[model samples]
Target: MSQSTESTTESNPFTRPGFIVAAAMVVALVAVGIVIFLLPKGQSSAEPAPASSSTVTASPSASSDGGKSICGLPGSAETTLGTAPQSKWELVGRIATPTDPKTFGPGESDSSGFRTCFAHSPTGALYAAMNIVALGSSGSTDLEQKLADKLLVPGAGRDAAMRQAAADSRTTGSSTPIQVRGFLIKSYTPGEANIDLAFETDKGALGRTTLSMRWMDGDWKVKPADDGTTYMGATQIRDLSGLILWSGV
Candidate 1:
């Protein structure tokens, strides 16, 4: 059997050192089979326009047509969430580790994190309560525009994905987090806030992963965590919670 362990900082939430719990979720999983996967922000009904190397914000620039100013973009002084009103990203796809980060490209990486339904705290941090779902090594994402539609936690897309992952995790009358922590950053709009986070599982740990997001339309959205992965898009369901896993719920 593969040996691993993940420890979440149960001390002070603010001072606690974020964990990655990626040992088995990443390294050991490679010994078997599987790999990593993948954005965020914007609160508008994207009219399906041209997007290829999006026009990044300048000093917290403005979105097209009197759009809001986003804080999650690539260049912004002291970022904050819900800052952008226009910004789009896509999830080309996912790849296995023991592979090349370059070949995988970038967008967002789900490492030691809880359910996607979990919301980022107003303070721009993930809540400790999320440690419960931080199991396995899998990731997901959606375009920045989609975030505008469903920026709150437990949105339909996130909830659905979490339930699917939790249920699919079943094996031998039990579940085990696949052990995956995506680590990579690339580009962004500008002035978007970031969530420096990470988590732990029974089999692994993630050191710290900074989650970037911007406020658009009226809610917060996830930005590219880095050349990690692109936004996969949204689904139709909603609900809570977060990272660090054990044997059962």
Candidate 2:
């Protein structure tokens, strides 16, 4: 499951046009299916799943309080925006994931095989979004189901994801790995956040997607789209011009 992030001038599989298309498709399906699996029957490459009501307005108490506990985890008072935040990269379930112990979490884990406990700050939300995508696309069916059960908000979207996981039996394909290259925080409140994430393929193809996060129970969980996928508004990008570039790769 370990692969190099280096670029090569020689003929390589990642540089091929076919691999780029597959990689783009894999990015689109990050929260719905494994990166190496094909789209569900009848889902078209040109047609995206309907967008979900993932955006939420900030509440009156949305401001950051460094001394207060937002979700039973340590709180961060930092409210700075429009800059790349700090992160450390480590392999989580076979995919490179970002982590910040002081802020963002998976600060705690249990026998259920799910990572939890993240800070309730903007940076924390950013890290949570990245980790969720990485873990969901880690190519493990059981892990995917566990994430859907534990880290996704309880809703029709979660129910659909649970059903899809139970029914998933597709063989892995030759899709290349997708990496998080940059991000933008579309909006945030203490209770909810809408984050835009930038993804890149090994061949340098770029795409963007949005994730809605809600502070639930004592941790941050992804709020899936109405269709049961973890992300929405996925589209190919020409470059990383407008993003605050950040990556663990």
Candidate 3:
């Protein structure tokens, strides 16, 4: 990438346009069991379109158990997995993310970067998976490297991701906005969870991906696939037939 392209990617990693194209590229690569955080080039440099005026603000419910957990964060009694979670949308890195403070946390944000803490429940795993996806696709290689180091499971996958981040830094691309459409908890246990997330691009393209999360150090960290990438089994969906059909839009 050229110096100008690198500067643009660093300056505004999340608000670029044509993310659907980038997502398509990812899907194609993942089909062959390879995943890389590369976005398509030559997209318009225009600012992202503003979110709708009717966007709802998040109102986290108070925990029934006096708002405390074993992790010393706000806790919720919701343990059973449900298809639809009560969530409101808020922009994170220009993507509309779902948040339910009482249930899933990002109970706290690390001053160091996009790293945030989540609850130790199934719902928390769901939130963590989504948040990581958004942050990983932010189009800033530096930010991605930091996230991989701090939020991914400690193993060869994490090491490989760090190396990939360093290589990606030399490349540059713009990021278009995408929104969380729905999710499905394939399986859940106290120690591990598999979450399937549905997404809609600004141009109405639909895509889906799965994340494997492991409970680590009192928080949920993405468990990398055998290929050493956090996102496993990504594909474009023609419809939301298998999804729970929920969205903040």
RMSD of each: 17.4, 10.9, 9.5
lDDT of 3 by residue, 1-249 (tens): 355444443434332222112333343333333444332364343442332333222233444334233345543444445546666667656666767654566666555437467876666777787777767565656667777787878888777767766666432433435677777888876677888887776666556777888776777888775445676555666556555666667
Ranked candidates, highest lDDT first: 2, 3, 1
Candidates in order have lDDT scores of: 0.26, 0.60, 0.59
Cα deviation at 80, candidate 2, in Å, is 4.6
Instruction: Compose the digit string of candidate 1's lDDT tens values, residues 1-249.
Output: 222222111211111111112222332232233333211233333332222332223343333334321222221232233321122222122211221112111112344222222122222122211122122222222222222224323345444433333333211111233322222222233324434333333444223344445544422444332221212221111100122211111
Q: How many backbone clashes does candidate 3 have?
A: 1
- Candidates 2 and 3, the one with greater lDDT: 2
How much is 203 displaced in model 1, in angstroms?
2.4
Worst 10 residues of 1 by lDDT: 232-241
TM-score of each prediction: 0.27, 0.70, 0.68
